[model samples]
Target: MPALRNIRMLTRYTAWANERLFSALGELPAGEPLAARATGSGNMVRTLNHAYVVDRIWQAHLQGQPHGFTSRNTEDTPTLDALRIDQARIDAWYIEYADALTAEGHDEVVVFQFVDGGAGAMTRGDMLLHVVNHKTFHRGYVADMIYQVPARPPSMDLPVFLRDTVPRLT
Candidate 1:
């Protein structure tokens, strides 16, 4: 049950960190997010989009609903503003999801199909942790891309989030 508190903190932190990253990305020079990068996702926007897609997939899994995502990311990249809006909505959804969870519910296993059609199963708490970690990992990718743009990325480290945001690093 104590794990529920950690999950709630982590999900909220994820949202805060995401907002910081989006704010920094939004301030980049014109066309920076779409600028071609050597990464498999092609560009910063696309990489972030990949994270968004996964978030939705896991959300559907938790809700026992079909996500309808055929791929990890869409073929087209959304404008930074549009993606920011979408990410904010999903981030809030995650916060609410965590808040509403009971300890037993958090530990309940949810089975679902992956985007690649592979069958999968994970506990609700584990799924939330995965979602948090996945976004952080891709944010690192985006941070790297941000540096490649010869710009400074927002300081998105967990310590920063803890110190400047909410729910102290405890």
Candidate 2:
């Protein structure tokens, strides 16, 4: 039960951090020098787009819908405003999905093929954890890109989220 609660908490943090960062990204001036790297390697916008694609793929998998992202190199970039809107919608869906999950649901084994055409299976919980970790890893990449910009980068660290947003936890 504690582990389940912990997963839920992690899910919440993921959604919250995503919303905060995406909102900041939306506020960034379009066509500005800082925004030029939106599509560049290790860029915030690219990393965020990658996360969005992965999230959509996983959501499809979870919902038994046709999976997208057949190849890892698939490049797609929307306008900042469009990306933010899509991110919010997907984040909300993930939040709902996480909240509705039960221990039994976590234990459910899912068999699915990878984007690379490899078949595999994993517990729903493991896949969910992967989703969270994957996003966190790319978020760090985005933060690094932000550091390259002249302006100050937002504090996106999980501890920062915990301290500032969920202070009562300690």
Candidate 3:
């Protein structure tokens, strides 16, 4: 039960952090994120898009349904506004999914094929943790790109989220 609570908190933090990142991205001049960068994913928007795509893939895996993603990212990237909307939906879904899971459910092992046609299996909780960790990793990429724009990136640190945002949750 405590572990489920932690996962729920982490899921909530993921959603909160994503909302902050999107807001910060909104302040940048149009096309800034689309400009090629020298880091992962080649551009800011693409990096975030990659995170979103992975979120969707893991969401489908969690649901035991087809994810329809052959690669980690789509060939065409959505505009920031569209991507933010979709990302929020998935993030909220993760929060809800976490809230709905029981200790037993969290321990359930899911067997699914990797995008590279390999076998994989993970407990539901571990899969959820991976989703959070993956996004956090890509957000770091975005933060670096934000520095290239000479802009300050919003902080999404878990401690900050806990201190400021988690207490507001019921």
Candidate 4:
């Protein structure tokens, strides 16, 4: 299925980009991710955590289960090491899900409740895209925060992913 392949490619790209981002984050000076910023999430780690939370929420939706999240973010800001491990687990799940999804599965509509208690629905493929896009969006915020530290963030462009992670793609 072409659609399943696209979702698989996107999930893999997201995982690769996330790995790059975490590697860059690990290189930041101590406390940089935790340092207070003017952003809504207050700091880089919090922003990243929100993305993780949303990923899990979508994962639950895809599984037709309750996500058990009352908000978009958690109260605790996870340490970089812990967050990396958690994110990696979820990333692996997404990749496996995409790899195993059927041709017709991609177009199946999943009804879900948003964190704000709003009713929502999306096709499985669209939800996967949303998850990847959501991570990219917040990764931008973290990249900006990294810039504020007078540091460089790893280039996470999709072309970079294609060049570095999947050069075999025709």
**TM-scores, all models, native as reference:** 0.96, 0.85, 0.96, 0.96
lDDT tens string, model 2, 30-74? 643235564444356666787888888888777767776775434
Instruction: Report the error of model 1 at residue 168, Å.
Output: 6.5
CA RMSD per model (angstroms): 1.6, 2.7, 1.9, 1.1
Candidate 3, residue 115: CA error in Å? 0.4
lDDT of 1: 0.92
Which one wins by lDDT: 1 or 4? 4
Q: Model 2 scores what on Cα lDDT?
A: 0.73
Write down the lDDT of every candidate, Cα atoms only.
Answer: 0.92, 0.73, 0.92, 0.93
Q: Which stretches of candidate 1 lie over 4 Å from their true place?
A: 167-170
* Position 72, candidate 1: lDDT: 93
Question: Could you tell me the lDDT of residue 82 within candidate 2?
Answer: 76
Q: Weakest 10 consecutive residues, lDDT, candidate 4? A: 161-170
In candidate 3, stretches whose alpha carbon ends up further than 4 angstroms from where it belongs are: 168-170
Q: What is the alpha-carbon lDDT of model 3 when measured against the actual structure?
A: 0.92
Worst 10 residues of 1 by lDDT: 161-170
Residues 47-158, model 3: lDDT tens digits: 9999999999999999999899899999998999999999999998999999999999999999998888898999999999999999999998999899999899998899
Q: Candidate 2 regions off by >4 Å? A: 32-42, 167-170
Return whichever of 1 and 2 wins on TM-score: 1
Task: List model 1 lDDT by residue over 99-151, tens digit each.
Answer: 99999999898899988889999999999999999999999999999999999
Colliding pairs, model 2: none
What tens digits encode model 4's per-residue C-alpha lDDT throughout 91-126?
999999999888788998999999899899999999
